[model samples]
Target: MAGEELKPSTVISLADAMQAYSAGRYAEAEDIGCRIAAVHPNDPAVWNLLGVVARMTGRQPEAVACYRRGIAVAPDYAALWSNLGNALKDLKRCEAAIVCHRRALELEPDVATSLHNLGVALTAAGRDGEALHAYDAALAIEPANENVIWDRALSRLRLGDYAGGWQDYEARFGRDELPKRDLPGMRWNGGPYAGKTLLVAAEQGLGDGIWVARYLKRVKALGGEMIVECREPSRALLASMGVADRIILQGEPLPAVDFHIPQCSLPGVFTPDEAAIPTEPYITADPQERARLAPIIAAAAGERLKVGIVWGGSGTYASRADRDAKLAYFLAHFNIPGVQLFSLQKGPQEEELKALPAAPVVHLTPHTADMFETAAAVAELDLVIMTDTSVAHLAGALGKPVWVLLCRVPHWMWQYGRSDCAWYPSMRLFRQRTWGDWTGAFDEAAAALQMLVLQRSGKLLTV
Candidate 1:
């Protein structure tokens, strides 16, 4: 004991580093991980902890490198392989991620996490059938896994299994990221609401609210006075739709109601048959707002067909990078001789429009006031062309001719393998033939637009 020395301050054990990570002290975890990696370079556990810390801190490239190092040290380590797969999936390298996940499963079969990760990668790669199987396998192992349930629901919805999908979709309310609302009223259970006031609470994104608001009319018909709550930006737009007897902004004190339902839950409750799904638009802009914007848009368009274009949605969306197309693609493709394209895009991505070469495109996003104002502007347009975004839903809800450019695997509402949306009769969908192939979608859209222009000019009878 006379010559014995205590370990250096920089020395850290794998257990200590993991404890720091579990406590959410990511910076400390990263420091400890780096120290451990330096001294015990060949230790797979040290490299794995370093990778997890890097990923948690948004250093995905570093995470990938660390995971690879860990795999090199311990090739048969299933957890290391699975972690690498998750990092690759986050980077949108789904094919590579799928390989990693499969290798992880090969090393250790019957791992629920590996199965779930494999499902996610498969789904992102546009292999919904395989993803569904992976999810089912995961569910078999751990029946109450919320993440797996949610992913399986999305896979089901993508395959157009609405009945089962919507039921599993309820798991979102249980997810920590989307906390369940603690409202005063009783949660509605599809019971008769005759003579009872019902409050429909908003959930998820504005686009989700717009999409599900269609169900309000059905709720209104169920013989109840309905009150709808929405975000402030959407309050004016939802109010104009006239689907509810009263509309309130989120966070406001609510009036007494006999029953309440999250807006998304309406589908599960109503279970509208495929044929019963509403095809007509349920929302419109104020005529005064439309009248006000029509002349302004008409002056900009002259005699050319006015086409409103939105190339992106909110940048904060997890999948926006995949769903959004370059603004240049629209400028290059929508250059038909007799058509004028107006930029209906909002948010930070609108800056990209300024970099485009001189074209017959008018920027209207600057003048748009709110979602209602956007609806007013969309109403003035002869056609609206947009990627998956709120504007697409707004244009469709206003009953305007809208062409939606879709990613290879689009949102659940769009379904799959269809050029027409059941939710919006006036909407036409142009899907990517391959993943991330916006050019193909744009080319098809251009051809459709040419036909639309001919139809408008009386050269073609129908489009």
Candidate 2:
């Protein structure tokens, strides 16, 4: 279509493939695109469409191959270059992706979408300053693009520019991919809303609710009775915080309130700088619940350094690859002589323990029903060691000693280049020095655990 003419039948087939792709029917699109690529190997459009479909279907290697073939046929095609860049980015080949994106821009400099994709690849590669500059360029071209604004918000937050970041973070609502609640009431923007009841509905995941629960107390101080609506799993934990005047679980009838706000947006209310963030433990396990779970833990631990471990987060998370590790990997490294490992992991990942030759850790997931119960079990333990999951937030909130293993590029909240968390003072972060490599992080954690065991037994002297 760019400069060459195709047979009427071929053109019709290509149009059909494009329509199928737009309808989210990946199978239909891929079939048509594959047929066309076989018949018309000389046309870059066929390969480009196939590449796009491959990327959508999560076959990143196939997508890269398709894009490369298309680029070979039509070296000047900016779309082919851009698509190749995206596929390479998905494969975590950031340097190659950056080169392809730059070539795309060279061919078509004014294309804002190309710039936005470039920014994403750059951010993934940890060149955040350059990424921000690219995002700024894209925004200058299309100021109203919500997706660009949302990404820019993440970069700004990662850089610790909380005030500016929160301002742009509001753009999240404009993107359709994120969940939205059409609750009954005007959304609370900020400032004092005296004498009026406010409903703070927890958004995203369980970890999100725990992380933002710290803001509820401050919201209450803004002169209104605050109501917290969270997932059923977290109701008890939220109730224990005593931050909200009333607590309601999700799926229940909405209580009448004058104003409603997403729990995650609470930070935007004050636009708090780093120093203003509440670092103290604001959540606790129910004392009664903790007492109940203590004996079970003590009987199993038998004076060894009691440690709880979670090797994975929720599978639905987009960046789970970077954030999660294999359960076998943890078992391999954490086989310390004087340490007792307890499994606090929930979700389908808990099944990974069954495939093991024998139970390496004490299975506590059976005793722990929800986040609150998990917290009680965690309270009885000497320490919690886990990947970045909801339990990490729970332990941190409880003021328990926690070691959080992180990927090279973690979430914006974890920020960049620090061994300790500002949000959780008791948290010690063990980050992977190389992308996709957890050996260094795991080895360091193993050494630290051994030291902890020694210190507890008075075998090692501490200053």
Instruction: Name the top TM-score candidate.
Output: 2
Q: Over the stretch 1-463, how does candidate 1's per-residue lDDT look in tens digits?
A: 1112213543335667778899999987777777666666788887888899899889999999999999998999999999999999888788999999999999999999999999999998889989999999999999999989999999988787878888889888778768877876898887778999999998888888998888888788886788998997798988887678999888899888889999988877766446667767888788998888888899989988999999999876778888999888987888787899898888888778776677568998777878988889998889999899998888888789999999978998888788998888899999997777788899999998998889888899976
Per-residue lDDT tens digits of candidate 2, residues 197-270?
99998678899999998888888988688889999889887887777899988889998889999888988775
Identify the runs in model 1 with alpha carbons over 4 angstroms from their true place. 1-12, 354-359, 454-463
Residue 89 in model 1: lDDT: 86
Q: Between which residue pairs do clashes occur in model 2?
A: none
Alpha-carbon RMSD, candidate 2: 2.7
In Å, residue 9's CA in model 2 sits off its true spot by: 4.7
Judged by whole-model lDDT over C-alpha atoms, candidate 1 comes out at 0.86
Q: Provide the global lDDT of candidate 2 against the true structure.
A: 0.88
Worst 10 residues of 1 by lDDT: 1-10
